[model samples]
Target: MSKTLIVYGSTTGNTESVSDDIAKILEKNGHSVEIQDAADISVDGLADQFDTVLLGCSTWGEDEIELQDDFIPLFENLEQAALKGKKVAVFGCGDSSYEYFCGAVDVIEEKAGELGAVLLGESLKIDGDPEPEEVSAWTESIMTKM
Candidate 1:
């Protein structure tokens, strides 16, 4: 079984809910999983213990892409996470009406690529409320890569 770590930042609980759903699916698949709230995590060597790392954050802003408040610090210090050649996946929740829907996911994917992490698949961008089946499917799709 793969050891997985899910780090997420949420304001209104939407992103947190998605994280829970993903964890449930991964656990049911027999993967050892741990969920960390971005506000409480230390980015230093964050991915060292996990075979797979999933990042989830919410995008905020009217004309700019602002990562969820608590995630900004972690995002800025991602290099300390030691993601080089590690398996990483990105996901986020956002409003589709905005110009940059789930923009945080795109930002993270780019950063992860720069860090040389092996991205599993396309990042899951949830618009508005998250659906259980959708989260499950996305989580399952990445299971193959792990």
Candidate 2:
């Protein structure tokens, strides 16, 4: 069984709901999972001891890409998490109408890749409300790949 950690930042609870859904699915798939709010964690050693990490954050701002409030610090100092060689996945919520939909997931995936984290799959970009089926399907795909 793989051990996975889910960290998320949500302003209006969309991303949070998605994170919870993912955790449930992963658990149902027989993986050990831990979920944390980004506000409660620091970048240092954030990915340590976990076989995989799933990061989720909502995108804010109209023109510029603004990561969720609590995720800013983590994004700023992602290298400190020491994720080299670790498996990772990214997901987030955003409005499709926005120019940069789910931009935070892109940024995090890019940075984690730069820091040598192996991406498990393509990210989940939720436009508007999150649906459990979508989250479950995405997570099941990740479990297969993991």
Candidate 3:
């Protein structure tokens, strides 16, 4: 079974809920999973214990992309996470009406790429409320890549 870590930052709980759903699906699939709030996690060597790392952060800001408040510190110190050669995936919740919908996901994906992390699948972006089926499907897709 793959050891997975899911770290998420949420303000309104949308992203957190999505993170929970993903964790449930992964666990049910026989993967060992750990879920954490970004506010409480240290980015240093974050991915070392897990075979795969998943990041979830909601986007804020009107004209530009702003990662969730609690995620700012983690995002800034992402290099310390030692993501190079690790399997990584990005996901988030956002409103489609926003100018840069799910912008946080895009930024995380780019940063992961720069760190030479192997991306498992396309980033999952849930517009508005998250649906369990959609989240499960996305998790299953990532599982296939593993």
Positional deviation of residue 100's Cα in model 2 after best superposition, in angstroms: 0.8
Report the C-alpha lDDT of model 3 over 39-133, residue by residue, as the tens digit: 99988999999999999999998899999999999999999999999999999999999999999999999999999999998999999999888
What is each predicted model's overall lDDT from 0 to 1?
Answer: 0.95, 0.92, 0.94
| Tens digit of per-residue lDDT, candidate 1, span 1-146 | 79999999999999999999999988998999999999999999999988999999999998999999999999999999999989999999999999988899999999999999999999999988998888989998999899
Which of 2 and 3 is the better model by lDDT? Answer: 3
Model 2 misplaced stretches (Cα beyond 4 Å): none
How many steric clashes between backbone atoms does each model show? 0, 0, 0
lDDT of 2 by residue, 57-127 (tens): 99988889999999999999999998999999999999999889898989999999999999998999999
What's the CA RMSD of model 3 in angstroms? 0.6
The alpha-carbon lDDT assigned to residue 70 of candidate 2 equals: 96
Q: What are the per-model C-alpha RMSD values against the true structure?
A: 0.6, 0.8, 0.6
Q: Score every model by TM-score.
A: 0.98, 0.97, 0.98
